[model samples]
Target chain A: MPGVLVIAEVADGKVLPVAFELLGAARALSAEGAGPVSALVPGQAHAQELIARGADVVYVAPESLAGQMYDAWLPAVDAALQQSGADIVLLGQTASLGRDLGPALAFAHRTAIAPEVTALKLENGRLRVTRPCYGGNARAEHTFAGQLQIASAKPKTFDALEPDASRTGEVKTIDAVGQSRITVLSVEKVESEGVRLEDADVVVAGGRGLGDPSAFAMLEELAKLLRGAVGASRAACDLGWYPPSSQVGLTGKTVSPTLYIAVAISGASQHMAGMSGSKNIVAINKDPEANMVKAAKYAVIDDYRKVLPAFIEEVRKLKAQG
Target chain B: MNIIVCVKQIPDPETPASSFRVDEAAKKVVPAQGIPPVVNPYDPQATEAALRLKEAAGGGKVTVISLGPESARDAIKHALAMGADEGILLNDPGFEGIDNFQTAVALAKAIEKVGQYDLILMGRAAADWDMGVVPMGVATLLGIPCVSIAKAIERVDGKVRVTRVLDDGFQTVEAPLPAVVSVSNEFGEPRYPQLRQIMLAAKKTVQVWNAADLGLSADQLGEANRWLKLEALYVPKVESKVEIIEADSPEEKARILAQKLRADKLI
Candidate 1:
C-alpha cells in the first residue's frame, strides 16, 4: 500500500495552519499503520518547517514557488504522490489555490477527489470522508473504491497536533517540472491594520442587535485593544453592515480560537455552526434570553450602547497601562 | 463572439430546516415536495455580463446551458427571459450526485455538443456548495486560461481585460480570446426581464439533452471518477451563557461595564 501524501501550502515562507491541520488528520489516519505521512512543501526553503510539523518526509522546491503557488504547487504535489506511491493525499479545503489546482491534478492522475471534508475515517478497507451540504444543514458520507484517493480537509474541522520538537524528518529538494500556462506578472501585498483574523487568538463578533451598524467600530476598537480580530454575524452581513467575507457562519469562515466575544447576537443556528468550536465564548446583549447567550461561556445583559463604549474605553486604558 | 453561460437550479437557501431531509443511505438531500428551486444567484451575474458582451458583439448569440433534472428547464427559461438567445438543458439521472469534477466533465461535453463559442462565462461560485471549483475545472479540462473572481471585464480591441479580486484586493489580467472568466457579484446587478421578453421566452424552444444523448453514461458521471469520499454529517453542537448588566445610574452601569470589559481583556 502506498503512503499518504499531504500538500503543505507555504505563503511568504510560513506554512498555513490549514497545512498542519491536514497533516494532523493524515497522521491520525496513518496511526492506523495504513501509510506514512509525507508532505510537499513548495518554496525556496520552507520544507524544514513542514518536517517539524509532522511530515515523515518533506519535498522542497528551491525556486521561488512562493509567487507561482499553483504552478510549483501542483507539480510538487503530483511528484510527492508519484514518489510516495501514495494512494491517499490530503489538502486544506479553504485555499483558493487548493480549489483551483486539486481537480486538475486529480484529472491528470485519473484519481478521485473529495472536497470540503469535515471528517475522515477508514471503513471496510476503504477511506470514508464526510462533508457538509445544503449550507451545513446535512452531512454526506462517501467511500472510495480506488486504490488512490485525495481529499481537501475543511479547516477548524480537524485538529493540528502539537509540534514534536524532538522529531526529525528527511528532506529532498526536487527539480521544478511542467511549463505553467499561468504566469505571475507581478505581486502586490496589502497591509492590514489590526491582527490578522486567521492568526487571531481571540475574536469578537457582533450582530444586528447593535442598533446602529456603525456600532461595529466599538467592537473593532475592543478587538484592537485585545489584539484580536473583529467578526460579524450573518445577520449583520445580510444587512450590509459588514462585507460578506467577514460574515461568520456555516457559509462563511470557520474560526476556532481561545476566546470568542459575541456582541448583540441572537445566535442563529447557522452562525453558531462556525464559532461553536471556540474554546471559550462570551456574549453581551440586552436580551437575557438571546440564543447567543445560551451558547456563550459568559453572558452579560446590557444595552450595547452602555456596554460597548465602556468596554472600548477600558480596553484602551488597559493597553495604555501595559 | 458567441458565449455560453452555465447555470444550476438549487434549493432556496431560506428553505426551512424542517422542510429538508438527508437520505444518508444515498448521501443526498431530499428537497421537500412543492418547494421551488431557483436559479443560482451567481449565474445571473454571469448572464448579465454575457448579455452585455452579446450586445457589444454586433448582436452575436448568447446561449444558456444548464445540467440538472428536468425541472432545470424552468431555470433555463428564466435565463431565456433575461435576454439569452437560446437555452439548452442537459438533464439526466446519471448526473445525480456528481461532484464538481464530474459536473465540469459533463458540462465540457455539453459545450462540445454546442460546438461554437469564443468565451465561456460562469459565476465565481455556486451557493449550494460554495465550492468555486466548477469554472476552474472546466477551464482546465478545456486547456484554456481561467480567471476567477472577476469583478469587471471589458473587451479591449480583440482581447479581454479582466479585473479579478484576489485574496487581498484585486488585479487586472489580460487574456486573449477564448478564455474562461468566472464573474463575481460586483460584475453588476442583473437586469429584470421585461414583460415582452418574458413572453418571448415562453415561445422560445428549450432543447433538452440527456446523458445518453450526449454519449455519456452513469459510469462516468458520479462515484466512478470521484477521488474523494464523504464519511459523515451531523449538526454542530453549541452551548453558551449570557449576562445582563442592569444598573440604576448610567454612570454606574458604564463603570461596571468598563470593569467587566477590562477583566475580559476585550478593551
Candidate 2:
C-alpha cells in the first residue's frame, strides 16, 4: 500500500509539538482509505511517542543528524522516503526547517510541494492540498502530477491525537551521509520572557486600533497573567509599536493558539490568515461590525481600554480562586 | 561585487478583504478594480538588501530582474528607483501561467545570461503565491547553496553572512560567494525613492528579453512543464457566529465573559 510519510521535527534535543501535529494530520488523511501513516525522526529518543500518536512505523536516523539544519536532515529524509516508498510526504511548515527544506526536496525529487497548507484530502486517489493564495484572500487547491507528492502544513492546523501508551509500532534505523557544504559558525537566540507565540495556548494580540504603543504593556500584563504570549498586528509593528518579531500576519509569523484574544484589531485578511486557525477567538473592539468582531466567537463591543483592566481583574480573581 | 535581485509584480496585497474575489471556473483571483499592481511587498526589501551590500562594498553593480507581463516593468523600475544600476525584464508570451519550478528554470537561465554576479537575492516569497520556492530552486539549478528568510545580510571575509529569523529566535549562517539568499520583511522598511531618483529611473532603458533570448524553448517555459496542477480555486466559506456580550458595565461584562469561558472549558 502507498503510505504517507511525515518528517518529525526535533529541536534542542526534544521533539517539537508540530511533529505530533503532522502525524495527527497524516493519520486523519490516511483514515479515509489512503494508507498507513509513518514518521521519520532524526533520532530514536521520540520514536515511542510518535507510535502512540498513530504512526504505524517510525524511521529514526543516526544521532549525529539530530540538529535542525536542512543539510543534516535531508539525507536521512531522502533515505526514509525511498525505503518507505510513500507516495505522500507531510512536513510541518516551520520557520527554521520546513520553509527551506520543502522547496529543496521538491527540486531534488522533481516534484511539486504545497507550502503553508491549511487542509488536505484525497479525491479520486490523488492528494489535494488547500493553501491560501493572494495573501489569504482566496484558497487554492493544488495537486501533483508527478509520482511523489510533498507538502507542508501550517502548525496548529490539525489537532494532535491523544497519546495511548498501550500502542506500539516498528522502529527502524536509517543511514545518513552527514555531508553538507555550508558551515554553521555560531547561533544567537533572543530569549523571550513568556511562551513562544506558536506554542502558546493563549495569545493576546494588539493592532493599530490600540492607539498607542504603550498599550501593548497592558496586553503583556494580561498575557503574563494568563501565562501566554503577546502578539501584534502588522499595522502595529509598522507603526514601530512593537518588535517585528512579535508581529503576527501573513508577511510575519503564522500563529495558531487555542485562544486568540484580539485587542483593538480590525481583522484584516493578512492578519486573519495568520491566526484564524485559533480554536477560539475573542475580540475587544469598539466597532461591532469590524471584521475581527464578526469572525470572533465572542466579542465585547467596547474600547479595549475600558475592557482590558476589568477582564484582567476577573481572570486574576478566577486564578486566585483556584 | 555584482548582485542580481529578483522582483515580481503582484496585485496590491493590502486591498481590503471585502473587495477580494475569485474566478472559480478559471481557478484564479479576480484582480480587484482600481487597485494598481505593486511590487511584491518583500521584493523592495530584497532590493534594499542588495543596495545596502553594494553601498557597503563602496563600489559594485546591482541589477534587478523580473519575470512577468509588460506591466511588470514597473517592478523593475521601482528597484532602479531604489538605486539599482540596471534592470532586466524577462517578458515573453510563452512565460505566462508557468509554475514556480519552470519560473526558477527561466530565472536561472537569465542569471547565466547576465554572466557575472557574486550574489543573487529575492524576496522570501511573492505576496501573491506565497510559495517561496524560486530562490532555492534557482540555487539548485545553478549548483549553489541557498540561505532563506534572512532578515540581515552582510559580506564577511568574501562570504555572505546572514542572520536568519527562526520560530523561536535567530541564527547566523555563512555561505560562499555566488550564493542565493531570500530576504524577509524583517530587514526593515525599504528606502523611499526621491523624486529625482524616480525621474532618472523612468529615463533608464530597461532591457526586455524573451524566452528565446534566454535560450529556453516555448515547451519548457509554461504550464506544460509545471509540476503542480491547480485542481480548484475558490473563496473559502467563512462562517462565524459571534456572541456579543452585553452588560450594563465593563466590570459586569468582564465577569460574565470569564464565567462563560470557564463554563465552556476554554480558559
Candidate 3:
C-alpha cells in the first residue's frame, strides 16, 4: 500500500510545531485507506516526537544534512519518498525552506504541488487540495494527475495531536546526498524584538490608515502589552512604515492566530487572504464600511489613533487586575 | 548583463469584495466590470529589480516578458514605461488556461529562444493564483539555481547576492550568475512611469511570440498538459456577524470591547 510521507522540519535543533501539524494533516488523509504514515527529518533530534504524533515510520537524514541548503536536503527527501513508496507527500509551509523545496522537488519528480494548502482529503484514490486564490477572495480546489501527490500545508491550519507516550515506531537513519550549487558566503540574522509573528497567538496588525510610519510604535506598545506580536499590512510595509518580515497578506505571510487585531486596515482582499483564518478578528477603522470591519467579529468605528491608546490602557489594567 | 523579467496581468487586487465573482463552470474569476486589469502588483517590483540591476551593471538590457491575452501587452508596456529596454509577449490561443508548471515550461522555452541572458526575475507570486511556483519551475527547467522571496538583491562580485525574507527574520544568500530570483513586495516601491516615458513606450513595438515560435507543440502546452486540474473555484461564504461596539466615547468603547473580549475569552 502506498503510504503518506511527511517531511518533519527542524529549526534551531528543535522540530517546528508545524511538523506535528503536518503529521496531523497527513494522519487524517491516511485514515481513508491511504496507508501508514511515514515521516522524514533531516536530523535525529526530532524523530521520536514525530513517532508520537502519528508517523508509523521515521527516517532520519544524516546530522550533516541539518542546516543544509534545499539542494542538499532534496535528495535525502527524494530517497525517503522512494524508499517509503509513499504516493502522497506533505510538508509544512516554511518561509524560506519549504517554499523553495516543494516546487523544486515537485519539478524534479515531475509531479504537481499545491502550495499553502489549507485543506486536503483523499477522494476516490485522488488527493484533493484546497488553497486560496485571487488573493484569498476565493478558494480553488485542485487535484493532481501525476502518480505522486504533494502539498505544503499552511501552519496553524490544523491542530497537532497530543503526543502518545506509549506509541512506538521504527526509526532509521539515512545518508544525505547532493551538494548545493549556491554558496552562502554569510548569513546575517536580523534580531527581532518580540514574539515571532507566525508563532504568536495574537497579532496586532497596522495599515496605511495609521497616518504615518511612526504610528506603528503605538501598535507595538499594544502588542507588547498583550504579549503578542506586531504585524503590518502590505500597504504599511510598502510605505516603509514597517519591515517586510512583519507583513501579513497574500504576497507576505499567511497567519492564523487565535486573535487578530486590525488597526486602520482597509482589509484589501490581498491582506484578508493572510489573516482571514484567524479565530477572532477585531477591526478598528473610522470607516464603518471598510472591508476589515465587514469581515471582523467586532468593530470599533472610530479613529484608531483615538481608540488605540484607550484600548491599550484598558488591556493593561485588565492584566494588572489579574 | 542581460535580464529577463516576467510580468503578468491580473485583475486589480483592490476590487471590492462584493464585486468579485467567479464563474464556477469555467473555473475562473470573472473580471470585475469597469475595473481594468492591472499588472500583478509584484511584477512591477520584479521589473524594478531588473532595471536597477541593468543600471548598476553600467550597460545591459532589461526585457519584460508576459504570457497572457493581448491585453497583457499593457503589463509589458507598463514595464517598458518604467524604463525596461524591451518587451516580449507570448500570446497564443494554445497557451490559454495553462497551469503554473506548463506556464513555466513555456516561459523557459521563451527564454531559450531569446538566447543569452545573465539573469531571470519574477514576482514572488501572482496576486491572482498566488501559487509562487513558476519561477522555481522555470529555473528547474532551465537548469539554474533559484532564490525566492528576495527583499533585496544586488550583483556583488559578479554573483547575485540576495537578502531573502523569512518568517522570523532575514538571511543573505549568494548564487552564481544566470540565476533566477523572485522579488518580493518588500523590495521597495517600484517607480512610477513619467508621461514622456509612457509616450515613448507607446511607440516601442512589443515582440509577439507563439507556441510555434518557442518550438512547442500543441500537445506540449495549455490545460491538457497541465499537471494539476482545477476541481473548483468559488468564493468562500463569509458569514461574519460583526457586533459594533457603540459607546458615547472612545474610552467607553475600549472598555466595552475589553469586557466583550474577556467574556468571549479572546484575550
Better of 1 and 3 by TM-score: 3
The numbered model that scores best in TM-score is 2
What is the C-alpha lDDT profile of model 1 across B101-177, one tens digit per residue?
77888888888889887889998877776667788777777777677777787787777777766544556666666
Q: List ranges where model 1 is wrong by over 4 Å.
A: A69-72, A94-96, A154-157, A162-165, A186-188, A250-252, A268-270, A285-291, A310-322, B16-20, B32-35, B156-160, B174-177, B221-267
Between prediction 1 and prediction 2, the one with superior TM-score is 2
For residue B116, model 1's alpha carbon misses the true position, in angstroms, by 1.0
lDDT of 3 by residue, B1-267 (tens): 899999999999888888999999999889899999999989999999998888889998998899999999999999999999899999999888989888998899999988889999999999888889999999999999999989899999889999888776777889998999999877888999999999999999999999899989977777778898889999988666999999999888988898788788887
Candidate 3: pairs in clash: none
Model 1's TM-score against the true structure:
0.87
Q: Which of the two candidates, 1 or 2, achieves a greater DockQ against the reference?
A: 2
Q: 1 or 3: which has the higher DockQ?
A: 3
Model 1's DockQ score: 0.45
Q: What shift in Å separates residue B252 of candidate 2 from its native position after superposition?
A: 3.8
Q: How much does each candidate deviate at the interface, measured as C-alpha RMSD after superposition?
A: 3.9, 1.5, 1.9
